[model samples]
Target: MTRPSLLAAIAIASLSTITTGAFAADQLVVASFGGAYTASQSKAFIEPYMAEKGAKVLTADYNGGLAELRSQVQSGNGAWDVIDLELQDALRACDDGLIEKIDASQLAPAADGTAAADDFLPGTLMDCGVGTIMWSNIIAYDKTKFQNGGPKTIADFFDLEKFPGKRGLSNKPNVNLEWALMADGVPNDKIYETLATEEGLNRAFAKLDTIKKDAVFWGAHAQAPQLLADGEVVMTAAANGRIYDAISKEHKPFEIVWDGQIWNLDVWAISKASKNKDAALDFVKFSTTGPRLADVTKYISYGPVRKSSQGLVPEAIRTNLPTYETNFKTSLANDLEFWADHQDEINQRWATWMAK
Candidate 1:
């Protein structure tokens, strides 16, 4: 099927679940990054919510950014009711009034009676966003390409002489900058502190320049895995869950290297211009419950935000999660506040560097 027609078919199928005939007024539109992540949300959150509320829920996919949400809010015609955003974008959007502020009291408490605020991990809840999952961007490579183990550390990713091939990196400056700094010998704890300065920014760009000619920049999550599979790049930086999905479901030989993995939260925020404010808020409350958050692990490798949800995750999947102790030992939590403060300046710098 043609791409447009296929999307139309998916939309029709989603609307059909409402059991109501051709009613568009009551529908809720949710926006998220596409691929395995959205598929997991569809199973663990959207489908169940639709079944219980008998509400039509349409899904829209986007490469993560604040531009679309910003445009919708400015024009007062938001097409999305709820959106999944990276931590930095969520913070920026909430501060800019592009999304509605959520009352913590309105959220459902854990099954054990703990308050929602106390149950969620520290820094997960924000004024306008409810934390959904904790995920990571890690180095993933085809195991077959490396006979004697693989690039084991963040530094090794930049060592083209040791492991020669094209490298795949996200086109954005967020994680790439962090990885570049780490690979250049900046300690994890001191990453943002160092990056906040002019010299540090130059250091990161200089490190990245080493691989610029051989780098394959990908804009979407799915492209990372496809690049490795097609041998377009020997190794790529990818979301941990995407690599996990490819390995476990498709039996791909990709392996994830946890060293210097940059982890962050994905939050669900309501667009300020949403037509269905109350319904959208209700959906957020429903989907973030302890049980619902835990249920998502059945579909993806992301860790749930609620403490109560941790024990509920199956043992098999728990070890694969970004929160798993062994995997997290060398991980760095992406500093959302730092990015919120410096994103514009850094992005401008990144664009200039790319042009060169």
Candidate 2:
């Protein structure tokens, strides 16, 4: 071949290499709490987005917290482009400038053309993050554990003489404090207000003290269901989705007690330091559409945050969601603002209580 022809061939090869390198770098890394929750997201969001956009996606799982996200941001080498955060963590991360500010205007509207901002449930759309799903923490008991009707209320959870078995509780103080306050006779509307004072704090701990010895504390989402399945704890505080998966898929004889259930939102936020910020934001937009949000319910029991998505969910799945009328009757929405202000102090106290 002539020298000119050889040069042309070399140029084509170099261009192909550059294009491949750029395409590889365009992939987005998303992080979230693992287990059935992530599985639902994989089916409902990630896989579909990749297929539609021809983009590469990677996933990382972390038991929920701000420590790993903080480390990544502070070090200026963020490994995750998109992160799924509990509402309080999202608030704190946004305040500390750890995540990118999202523009709600860019989100897709409802099928009927309602604005995205107005379509989302109140308190879900934030400056830095967009809410994805609403999930709840509730008491799950083995149906076979008690011949008599099992725990029926939050108060029953603390009654050792009546329930007569080891209890499973999350190691975190968030829901436990609220449940303690509720079980101790504080009214639902007064829960956070009651927990704000010194006397209230002591009262919660004192109520918790009633079952500390018999309580088995679990730190991860999966552990709650496993504790009950393994018979380590007769009843455990579990994510509703996890318990639903165990019952529906594994055919476990577990039942969820929705009384005094504490529900919260999981938000999607972009890392401030992500090299793929644009791609990350695009994925977030795509995943949060009403159709996509509703699709998640087909896999897990979590309720979609979009008001429009509610209609998309079938009646069978809708009835099992946390937002279902019967299930939500006695539920309490977690106060993200309260946790944002009090998490550090509460965590410190939680550690002390755990030690004792």
Report every candidate's CA lDDT. Answer: 0.86, 0.87
Q: Candidate 2 — what's its lDDT?
A: 0.87
Q: What is the C-alpha lDDT profile of model 2 across 67-144, one tens digit per residue?
A: 998999989898999999987788788779898877677788899999898898777877788899999999999999
Tens digit of lDDT per residue, candidate 1, span 49-142?
9998888888999999889999999999979999999877887786698888777767888998998988987777777788899999999988
For model 2, give the 10-residue run with minimal summed lDDT: 12-21
For candidate 1, the lDDT comes to 0.86
lDDT of 2 at 116: 91
Look at candidate 1 and give me any clashing residue pairs: none
Model 1 TM-score?
0.91
Q: In each prediction, how many residue pairs overlap at the backbone (N, C-alpha, C within less than 3 A)?
A: 0, 0
